[model samples]
Target: MGAWGPGIFSDDLAADIRGDYRELLEDQVPDDEATGRILAAYRHLDSDEVHVLWLALAAVQASLGRLDDEIKARALSVIDRGEGLEPWQEAGPQGLARREAALSKLRTQLTGPQPARRQVRRPWRHVTDLQPGDLLARVASNGDTCLLRVARIDDQRVGAAPVIELLDWKGQALPKDRQLRRLRPRYRDDGPHRPMTYRVARLRKKDPDWHDAGFERVAQGLQQQGDDALPPWSYCGWSQLGDEVDRLVGPPKAAQ
Candidate 1:
C-alpha cells in the first residue's frame, strides 16, 4: 500500500471512496463522462499504484456502455493491453462487487424525493466517414440497398450513453486490394424526401468482385437501429424504451 497522507481520509477510507467513484464510472449512467472522471480520480496515484486501476478500469470499460462503437473502441483498447490472462480473473470478482455497491447506492440517491441528476435525453448521432475497416449495413427501401455505419457517439444524442451513426458508406465485402471504378449512392425510396444510401458500384480483386471479409467479421460488433432514422437505429438502441418518452416529448424543431 502507498503511504497514507494527511488532510485526506485514512488510506482505507480514501481507497473506498476512490473505489466508489471508479465503480460509478464503470456503470451505465455517466458513460462518456466516466472516462475523464476515472482518469482524474487516479491523478494522485503514482504510476506503479495505477497498474491495478488500469486493470479494473480496462475490464469493465468494454461492457459498461450500450453504444456499440464506443464499446468496440474500449474493447479494442482493453484487449490490446494484454489483459487476456491471470490477474484479471483474480481481480474480477471484487471489482464487480464494488461496481454493484456503487450503482445500487446511486439508484437510491437519484430516486430520492429531491433527486440529483438533471433530466436529459442523450441520443446517438448518425455515423459518417465510412472506411475500409468499418462494418457495413444495407437497409431495404425501394428495391435498392443503402449502406450505413455507426460512426460517432455523444452525450446529447444518447443520454449518459449515446451513439452516433453514419450512413452512405460502402461496407460491402470486397476481395483484398480490390478497386472500384465507381461508387454508387442509392436512395432507399423512389419518392422525394427519401434519405440517401451509398454503396460501391463494382469491386475487383485484381480479378473480380470485392470481398467484404473484414466487414463481415466486424458486423457483429455494431449495433443496429430500426424503423426510426435514416441509417436505421433507435437512438442506436441505447434504450428503445425511450421511444415512448420521446413520443411524450416532441423532437425539437430547427430554425426556419
Candidate 2:
C-alpha cells in the first residue's frame, strides 16, 4: 500500500494491508484471520502513518462512503493532536486543512446516491469564477456576516480544486483551504449537531445601489452637521452591517 517497512510505516503494518490482503485473495488466509491481521496492523502505525494508511485503505475500498465516519475520526485524531509532532511533519492549521480537503475530494469522487435514488443537489459554482476585487458577503458560523472581496485565485492541477482567496473587511486574507459550505433554503432541528453541518450562503454579484437609500439618508445627516466622516467602527460592527445588507436585498447571484 505504501513504502515497505522501517520507513514511515512499520513492516508488520505494510505486510498486513499490502501482503495479507493479497494472501486472502489467494485463499491462503481466511476472511476472519485476514480481518484480525489487518486490525492488528493498525496498532503498529505511528501518528505519521495514520493518514497514509487511511488513504491507502480508501484506495482499495469500492465505496469510500462506507468508511467515511471512520476516516473522519482517525484523520481528526492525528490532525488535531495536542502533543507536539516531529518538525518534519509540518503540522499546522493550513496543513491540516489541506489534508482534510484531500479527504473531501476523495469522498466526493468515491460516493454518491445511486442513479435511481439520486436527487439533484445544489451545484456549487467554481470558486475561480470570482475575480479579484469582486465583492461578496460571508456569513460566519455564529450567523454573523461580513463583507469580503476576492483577493486571488490559485490554480492547481488541471482537474484539481482551485484555492479561493478572500479579503475580509479589514483587508485580511483568509486561509485558502478554509472550508466553505452551502446554505440550504430550509432548515430543520434534528438534535445536537456539529457546527460544520450548518452553512451560510456566500454571496457574489449584487446591485451596488441596493444600499443607496440608507446611505443617502446618512449623507443628508452628514451634510447638515458639516461632518464628512462617519462614526468609526471595527469589524464586529461591519458584520452586522453586512447581514443587514444581505437581508434587505437578498443573496447575490453566484458567478457562473
The candidate that wins on TM-score is 2
Off by over 4 Å in 2: 1-16, 28-33, 63-101, 109-256
Off by over 4 Å in 1: 1-29, 66-256
What is candidate 2's CA lDDT for residue 93?
64
Which lDDT tens digits does candidate 1 get at residues 1-256? 3323211122353455445544564355475676567667666866445434443443343223222244334434433453322432445776445534443443332223332333333233333233332444332222222233333333232122212233433332532322321223334434564444222211122211113221222342333334123332232231222222233234433557
After best superposition, candidate 1 residue 30: deviation in angstroms? 2.5
**TM-score for predicted model 2 compared with the true structure:** 0.26
How far does residue 110 in candidate 2 sit from its true spot (Å)?
5.6
TM-score of 1: 0.21
**RMSD (Å) of each candidate, 1 decimal:** 20.7, 20.1
lDDT of 2 by residue, 106-223 (tens): 4554454412312222333323333333345454333344433322233332211111122223212322322221111121124432111111122333322213212111111101
lDDT of 2 at 223: 14
Worst 10 contiguous positions by lDDT, candidate 2: 215-224
